[model samples]
Target: MLYSDKAPDPVGLYPHARRVGNLLFLSGVGPRKKGSKDIPGVTLDNHGNIIAYDIEQQCHAVFENVRFILEASGARWENLVDVTVYLTNMKADFATFNKIYATYFKENQPCRTTVEVNALPTPIAIELKCIAAFEDK
Candidate 1:
């Protein structure tokens, strides 16, 4: 199990990542900054509902969070073998998210699945679940 002080605190009681054999499985990572509840690019209404969000920003932040977990687990970005993306509004956010994703994933094109969901546990617009493979040293 890995817990990263450089990554955001998980919403629930779960480690940032777990290593088994040569594979590292990361729990869902969001756009929130480390040690904070604030989600990047998200603007919440007075009632704590999402009023607006920038998908590009969230994508970058989530990717960074994933990186933090990977580093904590002694894995690299290129080691990612699979990725699952959760989006709150596919129609509004997919294109922006894809554009940003390409910049990070153009070389290491992992198997990816993106899905639209009603919402996340928080007001963030995007989250990522990832699996990575490392050599048994």
Candidate 2:
């Protein structure tokens, strides 16, 4: 099944998440707000050059978006089995991201992989791709 709702709409034609059997696979979720092009923490100049940003804010938004998707799919933070994090600047943001991440995942830590990349499709700092498993019927 496909899940999409008031959460940030997918930038592409894909659904926010898809469930195969018990596992729900979420598409890359960014910090962009739903029904708007604005991305949290993104500050642009008149010419669209990034003047400033807050990684912490972006991280929170991304996780909120991920949470919405997970819940919409009948899953929760505890149901997540794995997560893949994409960061535009790992060296600069990893420490901050890790701190915030720990708060959310807490003792229910799932397998995770974080990687640095040149950029995402949008001007956000972080995106999350997650997999969650629902209880078997």
Candidate 3:
């Protein structure tokens, strides 16, 4: 009964499903809207904006967004086994990023890796991609 149900990723090119016995590997999700959200404030001209945003706020949203995707797929943050974070300004803002991230997976710490990048789909300051695992029941 292992199978992928939904994907949060905008580009549908990637398969959102993978199965191995009782395990499923869902694709990573970001904060970009499938279409658009009219997110307002001080957003990038080409994308949505946050008026009072810092690495902390953005990190929270990114994790929450991934949690939503996992829930839709019948999984939870506790099911996450690995998380990969991408940041445009990692060296400068990562301290706050890790702080916020700690709150989400406080109970279950998964293997994690963060990389610094030059840009992301949106100018939201931070982007997170994760892999979740749930026991088949």
Q: RMSD per prediction, one decimal?
A: 0.9, 1.2, 4.0
Candidate 1, 46-104: lDDT as tens digits: 99998888888899899999999999888999999999999989998899899899999
Better of 2 and 3 by lDDT: 2
Off-target runs (Cα >4 Å) in candidate 2 are none
The regions of model 1 sitting more than 4 angstroms off are none
Every model's TM-score? 0.96, 0.94, 0.73
- Rank candidates by TM-score, best first: 1, 2, 3
Poorest lDDT segment (10 consecutive residues) of candidate 3? 38-47
Task: Give per-residue lDDT, candidate 1, residue 118.
Answer: 91
Looking at model 1, the pairs that clash are none
Which tens-of-lDDT digit does each residue in 32-133 have in candidate 2?
A: 888887788999887776788999999889888888888888788899999999999999999999999999988788999999999898788899999999
**Which candidate has the highest TM-score of all?**
1
Count of clashing residue pairs in every prediction: 0, 0, 1
Better model by TM-score: candidate 2 vs candidate 3: 2
In the predicted model 2, the residue pairs found to clash are none
Name the 10 consecutive residues with the lowest summed lDDT in model 2: 1-10
